[model samples]
Every structure is written in structure tokens, then in C-alpha cells.
Target: MARSLKNPKKRKNKGSKKGGGASSSSIPSLPTKVWQPGVDKLEEGEELQCDPSAYNSLHAFHIGWPCLSFDILHDQLGLIRTGFPQTVYCIAGTQAEKAPWNYIGVFKLSKISGKRRDLVPKRHDDDGDGDDDMDSESSSDDEEEGGEGESQPPVLQLHKVAHEGGVNRIRAMAQNPHICASWADTGRVQIWDLSADLNALAESEADVSTGGSTLLSRAPLIKFGGHKDEGYALDWSPLVSGRLLSGDCKNCIYLWEPSSSATWNVDPSPFIGHTASVEDLQWSPTEPDVFASCSVDWTIAIWDARRGKSPAAVIKAHKADVNVISWNRLASCMIASGSDDGTFSIHDLRQLQGDSRVAHFEYHKLPITSIEWSPHEPSTLAVSSADNQLTIWDLSLEKDEEEEAEFKAQIKEKVDVPEDLPPQLLFVHQGQKDLKELHWHGQIPGMLMSTAADGFNILMPSNIENTLPSENS
Candidate 1:
């Protein structure tokens, strides 16, 4: 008699190879950034340049794109080491290729605070702190600022985490950096417990299997299989501690509510809307249960986690497959979506109708792969495309004082939005290839991080050091 092996909580040895030989055999040959003899391949024409702000590639070193890959956008990227040695790494999608098993690469950087005093451009310090740590407040005063200083090249290193079939997606716990959840292509959702202290957060140096100065988990704390088909996206709830959402190539989104300390019970029914695979998922910053998703079906949909049956709002988002989407951290109503057709559009959630696109960007002749709105500046955006280009956009044509008040009024009162005007292009970053992803540094006001098919770069503007904190911030 055949039985369904979908949700494995009830069945014994059902979905996953829990432990023993099967689990051991399935462990993948993970790669790091150290550039092994046969393991790593340098991008064509990639040369070693002494770039102060750029770090070596920490992206998935060996794993190529999947047939139905889940592109990395909102789940976050790059790994950093504070006193506790925290950094971010992304899981590439789908089943393993001819390179053996699936691979995940982690690039870690040391948290050197005052190390780049000479490299960073001088800043006018009003507070008299004697030093600018780059965590300046974001206000109208800093809007005109650009990256003029030398790039503070990070003390970068790479680490490894092994699993079956590459990581389809990974969600780092917001409340605790030591905790992370991963969705695997082999149909398992696993939680990994990292060490809290710098020494405790990862395994010892001897276990740095990927080479130079490594600290990564060799195995998951615990894992379970509940979904069918390859996984695509997963998001850790920003408001709730344990709740998470996982989506697959089948357009099925599962709600994993914690049943106990170690186990998660998957709700039987998956949220449905997209006719194709869900590409990316992000939890709303303002509302706890509200989230948004973009799919290959050329649509972006907003969902209320409680109402699992239908989407709260749907936007016929793009001409081609919507590659990625992100919610603006500062502007609650503002959102951005990138597509395979080399265009990106911004939308106001308040106006989710057929023609609700507030702004459209078609600067890239190649398909846009990643888009990030500055968490520090509401009007600022960073975009990367398949053509190996990165551009920063100042999404405002109004004067400074008028724009600040306009934004404040828009946020406070649901005032009628002004007609959409094309934003000015701020700056273009050079010296990169296969530029797939870009993000603004949370701590540094204008600092940006970019990843490509070649490697990763930390971009700083000539005027990134100017800023006074916002009143609420």
C-alpha cells in the first residue's frame, strides 16, 4: 500500500533521512571562497585588483543556476563578524548538479570599527564624538551626500555549511543571529543553532573545512521534511519569534507554526495565488502578518498571513517573470519589484489597482536581477542587472525642504500622492561583472554592498559620511 510522504511529522522515516548512514551519505560537498584547485572558477576576465572596499566572492562558488531557481533578494546576503562573529550567507536553489552535491558559500568579515579611519572620507562631526563610525542618522541633511571616500576593504573570509541538494532558501532569525532556518531542495525544512559568542557561534578553526579561518555549522540542529518539490523562498517573521513562511516551485506557500521547541508543524493547506513558482517572499516591516510575494507569473501579490485562502491585493506586476521584490523600510506604502525584462517598478500598496505603478525604471538594457531601497533614505535606491551594471537612484525631483515635508506628510496623513516624477540617477559603480545583487548597509548611511557572478563588493560614496539622525531614529 502506498501512502503520502508529504508531511513527515507523523510518519516514521518518512520525508527525511533523519540520522545514520543515509543522512551522512547525503551531506553535500560544500564550497567556500578560498578558490580551490578544481572547486572554484574565476569569472572570465576577472583579475585581482587591490580594491580597498571590495571583498572576495562569497557567493555560491560552484553551484550554477537551477532550472526553477529561487533568486536571492529579500532573504538578505553577506556575512559580518561582530564580537559574536555574525554574518549572512544565502542558499542557492534546486537539486545538485554534476559537481557532485549542492553547495552553499558564506563570506565572513571581521567587525573592525575604527580600522578604516584613514580610508573613509572625512565627515563633519556635529556631536563631537571625535570619530565617525559610519552609523550616522538619516535625515534631510544627508540626502545630498555621496560616496567620496576610499572603500574600507573588509577583512573577508569564507566558511561552509553542508546539506543535501543545495539550500533552496535561508532565513536568519531576526531576534537571534545564532538561529537560522533553511529550506532544502530534498524536501526538508531545517533549523540551525549557531553559537552565541564569537568563539561559540561556530565550530573551532580545525573544522574550518573550506580553509582559511572558518566558523560554520557542520550539520543542522534538527531538520524535517514537509513540502513536496524543490523549495524556493522562506521568510522569518519580523514580529513573531518562531513563525516562518516557505514557498515552493508548485506555487504552494506553507505556514510553519512552532509546535514545540524543536519541531514545527506545517499547516496542511498552502497559500495559493501565483500560477507559477513563487520566486521571493518578504515579511512586511510595519504589519506583523502582512507579507508580499513575486512570482514567475508576472505578478506581485500582498497577503495577510491569517487569510490564507486568497491574496489581499494583487498587482499585474511585470511584463516578464517578476525576479524579485522588496518593501521599503521607511515608507510603509512604497514597494519595489524587478523583472526578467530589464525593468523595475515602484508601487504604493495603498493603490494596488491595475495602473498603480508609482514609478517605472528601464535604465538597464539587461534584465534587472536585484533592487534595494535604502533603509536609511526613503527616496534612495540601488539596482543591479544581468549586464554587470550597478546604479544608485535618487527617487526625488523636488527640492530638499519641500521633499522632506512632502514625505513626512505622506507618511503621517494619507494625503493624495503627487504625480510620479522620474528620479535622478545618483551614481554608477564600475569594475564588476555578472552583477546579480545589491543592498544598503543598515549601519552605514550610504554604504552599499553588491554581489555578482564574479564576486562581492562593498561600495562607498564620496559623501556617505554626512548625516544627522532622524528624530524617531
Candidate 2:
């Protein structure tokens, strides 16, 4: 054995394993531990552990902001790339302890991928060359010395900046289908170039008497005058690029356009109609020549841009103050208006004859603060209220048909469930006691975002991954 131990590499033992280890047939196997679903594993007094992956699938949270009122701008291009891309631009008021409200900041919704990062330009370095470099440097210096020359100034780029004073409200318009403009209480209306600079907003610096240089600038394309009260609502003409309409607290509305003269004047044309403070104004998305305005006088007036003395039609359907008006994106002849009386009505412009309401929706316990039609699905509508709730409705689905046999049959066949099964309810988080605004994502039909007295919340359809399914399948 001693002799063989020295020469072990040259000889193999008879009891050796096949793979130079313990044989697979001789090895003993340990019992496998199978995990059963729904089993709770916890220590005494410890809280139950939820499935992290499952929780990650659900995106819901409150992004807090003070002073309550805020506005949401939906990203149209982002929605087309991602399945329900939840990108939204929010403008909120800022308050520091007892300090007066002064600062306003814009925030883009941070998605699951990561937080948004701004890309700023970096200075370029130049090395000494031959005659070409000398000529270039000489030309640049000459342009600087002359204060203006063939050399162009640095192109201005917008940056999202928080103001010292908070923003009270925001109004937005889509310049094209993709670009948008937002106006805040800072006496500033910012045009956001949505193509590449969604995160950047430019404010005109023409009003500044003295100031340091800034990466962003704002030029008041139009100036509105009339009401001493804060501007309530603003609407852009879907037909014209430079034309804008605004409403104020003095029961007056004005039409503003860029001056045609060499010395650009910012004066606006006055379009007067409402007797009480105007609450909201909306341009017909389909009819560029027609527009509508609502007021506390409990009336919604339809106006023609060609002539404005009195409204073409006065919708005196609401018993109380009309708070909001929205033109349907799908149907040009249909419109919706909400009132302080806790009710909303659908108006058919084609059938505006003797005492006829196309449809009426009454669900909110408090006054309806705002209303909007779904851009993706025309038959659906959303309304926000002071009662701290955002409700979604399907106009195609009749409430009276809930008990109908045909309706029950259709639901059972579609869901493959019993007829007694309750309808699925979609509830949005209100967070605080009152909700200020609710906006639907322009590109993603079923997704909506809302801002309330407490914070902001986003609601997405239950199954977004299956948004577009194979037709045959």
C-alpha cells in the first residue's frame, strides 16, 4: 500500500467512483422543499411581507404639493412609444412655513424606469491651429466687439425653474398636436417646445428691467387686459397659431393676436358677452370658427368668431353657476358643461331646440370643479369635484340598462362569468377632502391624472400591457 500510494496517478482503485467522486446511484438525495402560494412566513409581532414583484406592478402614490390647485399636461409622443407612458407635466404652488406663496415648480412624473435628468450644454474648448483658427477667433472677437455681427448669439434653451412665488393655476394649449403652451399665475405664459424640451419651459424676459443672463427667456406673444381679478381661463384658437382667448373675473373675455406692425403691439381684441365673472372658456376642437364660454350667471354661451354681440345660443340648462365647459373631441355637435349645483349636462348643438338635454350626469356630492372628455375614447368622460373624487363615465353605457336582460346576457358572454357578478369599479385616489382638477392623458385614453387639495395622483387602466391585442386572437 505504501508503494502504491507513491504511484497513485498510474493506478485506479476498484471502489473508486465513476466520476472520481461518490457514485450518483449511491448518493442520498435530500427532500425538496416546495413553497405553497399564499403561505405567510413571519416572526412574532412582525408585519406580513407582501410580494415585492406584485407591488412593483402596481404604480400608485401621492406626490404632495401645497396650495392645492395644479394642472397636468399629458405627453402625447411618449404614449405612442411606450404602452401607456405615464409622463405628465405638473405645475404646483410652493409654500414655506408662514412665508407667502411665491414659488412655482414644474415636475415631470418619474416613471418606473428612473427619474428624469436634464441635459445641459457644455462649453467647447478650442486648440490653436493655422490661419483658419486665427481667422475664426478674429471674426468671433469682432462680433463681440461690435455687439452684433455675422456671428450668432448662443441659442436660448428652456430650463424648468422654480419661481420664488408659487403658481396658483395653469392653462395649457397644444400648438400642434404634439407641442404645448402653459400659462401660470406669475403673469407668464410659457410655450413649452414639446418636441425635445418637454422638461424645459421658456419664460419671456422682456419685462425685466435689470437681470443677469438666463438660459431661458419668455416673450409675451400676447398681453391681455380688462379684469382686475386674476385670469380664470385661457383657450387657443384651434384654427390660428397666434390667436388666443382668455377670460377674467370681471365678466369679460378678450381675443389676443400678435401685432401686424413693425413695432409689435400686444393689444388684444375684446369679446364681451358674460354678465357675471367668466369661469371657463373652450374653443370648439372641431369647429375653429365657433367657441363657448361659461360663467357664474348660470349660462353657457356659444359664440361666433366672425361677430360677437350676443351668443348664438344660450344654454340656460343649469340651475346654478356654470363652472366648466368642454367640447367633445369625437362629436363636433356635442358639448358638456358642469355646474356648481353638483350636476353635469351633455348638450347636442344640433338639437338645441325646445327644452332638450341630450344627457345629464348627476353623481358628485359637491360642485363639479372641472370636466374633460377622453381624447382617446369619445364616449367616455371624466369630472372632478370639490367632494374629493374623480369619476369616469361611459356615455355609451346606459345606466337604465343595468337591469336589462340583453345587457346581462352581453356581459356574461363577454366576461364568461355569472350574470350576478358585480361590475368592476375604477376608483381614483382623492387623498384630501377636495379635488381641484382632473386631466386625462391625451395619448393614452384610459389613463388619467388628478391634483387635489393634498397632492397629485395618477390612474391607469387595470391591464395596460394588453392594450392592443391581436384582432384574430
Candidate 3:
């Protein structure tokens, strides 16, 4: 799924059969005075100091290569409010020493003011807006005590939503818009009411419990089960609050709706379709009835939730196993997929109705591991590869009149350079390693987080601010 525009744009020819270079007179001169602010005046050898007191105290760490996890907060804000009341729950794949792994940790963000008291100055409130009587009492108490007390920053707490056998590797978790967090693992799907425990862990010091203890204390509000194999991915139906979709490795997809019974039982046979192991599944944001799934059988199938027998549309799209598929949030007919053959395809469901093969792309040099669309900008997509790189594509770029003009403009711009700038190849994890998963942060549209064999890395769109400053800076 890597972007196709790796190298800079090349110039196009006008008169000659092949593209020609721009005339020397067309080149624009470099600006005389470039703007560089702050410490820009300092000499290269001179040392520049930073205010240690101004550094942010919040920090984030991953327990292991994140297998399947979601940010609790929406993308409107940044990283899970540093130490704010939050919880992180993840299911890690089995390591050499461990059988399957499930982790539920509560973390608190410590307030920064108290820890840096020595670096910060304090002041007394003399000009009070009200409470003149209380002010005199406070003055008397302050004179009697004559000492300073420090206040600490707020911390985030994590709690485990316990389940038996822990969480399986291929399962997926989703937070329903209704405020319930639901997860599909093994042969069952469990839903928990997260609103009740939003900040409860921050007040308790007792260790979080799992399994029967958790089941007895806070039982799953609902459970769905029918699949014979491990559920690979599950998503809450965007159009229905109590409805959910789950995909299993046995090539079955189930639609479940919670019953009003005492047990909150789920009806399992609402919808199902797929030929082989279902690798990934996504519910279309625009068309709730339409959902897509990719499988190891080298096919991408679209399903209509109302129908039962066969797929609404089946596409023999890849040369190898199709690992991931995603439906565009903005376009009901547009879909994207990644496959083992090291390429991605952008399909138009409407155009596929005819004999014409819709638009497609073959860009990655290694297995295309994952593909995600920009939450805010629907035309943009981010794809990760086994090559350890993540590339972005802007599908909105015109291919007609404006495109031809832009091509002519690019050729003219590169005429003066001896060697053109290299393509925008972002090394998501640097050292050559397989990227196992890629996800776009729910709250940050262009920002994506990826997990690799090496470690976890967060990537923001190229145009956004590089918040990770250089070590020297």
C-alpha cells in the first residue's frame, strides 16, 4: 500500500516526442532572506540551552508489540490525555515462553506542578475577588504554619475487563458509540460498560482482577458466539447500536444483535459469507448494509447484511492471499485492500458492476500488511508493508487537465538540479523488519501508529508538526 509518488515529479516534454527540459530563463531565483527564528542567530559551534523546566512530564510506553488495541479517546485530542484518567487494554500474541497473553493495566498521569516545585515559583493571593473574611483567616493560618505544601498532577488508571482464556491473538476490539467496549475472542464476543469505570481505578490501589473474579463482579453485558474457529476481527455496526459483526478464521462472518433476555443472549445467524480464512473485515461507514472482508483465499468479497447465501460481489483481486481490506468512509463505492503479493487495489463497487476492472494499484515491493484511510480526509490512505515502511496516497489528485499542467510544471522545476530529490520514503521502523499491524488513531486523522518486530512507532502526516524534536535541540 505504499504511495506511488516515491520520487519527485519529473518534467514532461512539450514539442519533442519525449518530454523536454525547461528553458534556463524559466527557472525561478532563490529567495535572498529565508526566515529562521529564535536560536537561528547562534553559530553552528555555539551551545544553545533549553529551559528544562518547560519540558512535558507525560510519557507513553507500549507493553509489547501491540497486536489489537484501540485508543479510548476520539481523534479530536492527541495521545490519550497524558496521564489523564484512562485505561489501556490489549491482547498480545503468544511469545516463546507464554501461552496466549492478555494484559489490562491502569496508568495515571502525574501532575507536573508538584514534581517541579523547585523549578517553579509560587505566589500568594493578596488581591482576592471575594472571601475577604476567609482571606484574613488564611493569612493567620499561613503565619502560624509558615511552610509550603506541594500538589501532584493527575494520573490515569487502568483496569482489566476480565475474560476466560485471556484474549486470543486474532480478535478485534471496538468501542461502540453508545459507550460500550466490545471484544471478540476465541468463540465469543463480550461487551463491557466502560462508562462506570472511567476514573474509578484512579481512586483504588488494589490490583485489578481477571477471569471468574471479574465475571462475578462485572459480568459481560452481552455475549455472542457461533463461530467454530478463532474470531479474527469484529466491528460494531455503525448504523446499529446493539448490533455487531464478527469474522472468524474459518471463513465465516456473523452478525449479532443483543437480546432483551436476562442473559443478553445474541442471535448468531444474521449474516455470513467468505470462502477461506477471513483475515480482516470492515463495516462500511457510509452504507451500513454493505461490508467487506478479505481472506487467505486471494479474494475480496462484499456482503449485504440483509441477504444470507452468497456475497453481494466477489472480486478475485490479488495474485496472492488478501490480508486486509478497508472501505472508504466518505465514498460508499470505493474500497481498498492489501495482499501477500506486495500490492494494493482501489476498487469502485459501482464500476465493478460492468465489464471494466476498476482502478487498482501495485506499489509495495513486499507483502502489503495493512491499509487504513484518513479518518478526516477520505481521499487519503495510509498503507504499511513488510518492508518496514508506511506510505500515504492522495487519491483526490486529478488525472486530467490540472494533472497535465502540474506535470509540465514539475519538469520545468527540476531542470536546474543535477540530481533530483529522492522519493518520500519514510522508514517507519528503520531497520528492515516486518510491520505486523498498522492503525490510524481514532482521534488523529492523519496520525497512524504501527507495530513491528522491532518496536512500536507513531507516524503523523508529513505535513503536520514533527513533535519529536531532535535530541540536540
Q: List the candidates' TM-scores in order.
A: 0.64, 0.62, 0.59
RMSD of each: 14.7, 24.1, 16.4
Q: In order, what lDDT does every prediction score?
A: 0.55, 0.50, 0.48
- Write model 3 residue lDDT over 319-404, tens digit each, in one string: 78887877877776778888887778888877766632355666566788778776666677777777555666767654466755
Choose the strongest candidate by TM-score. 1
Worst 10 residues of 1 by lDDT: 16-25
Please, what are the lDDT tens digits per residue for candidate 2 over residues 303-335? 987775567887786988888888887877778
Candidate 1 runs further than 4 Å off: 1-107, 111-153, 196-217, 222-224, 398-423, 463-465, 469-473
TM-score of 3: 0.59
TM-score, ranked from best to worst: 1, 2, 3
lDDT of 1: 0.55
Candidate 2 lDDT score relative to the true structure:
0.50
TM-score, structure 2 vs. true: 0.62
Q: For model 1, what is the error of residue 269's alpha carbon versus the real structure, in angstroms, after optimal superposition?
A: 0.9
- List, in order, the clash count of every candidate structure: 17, 10, 15
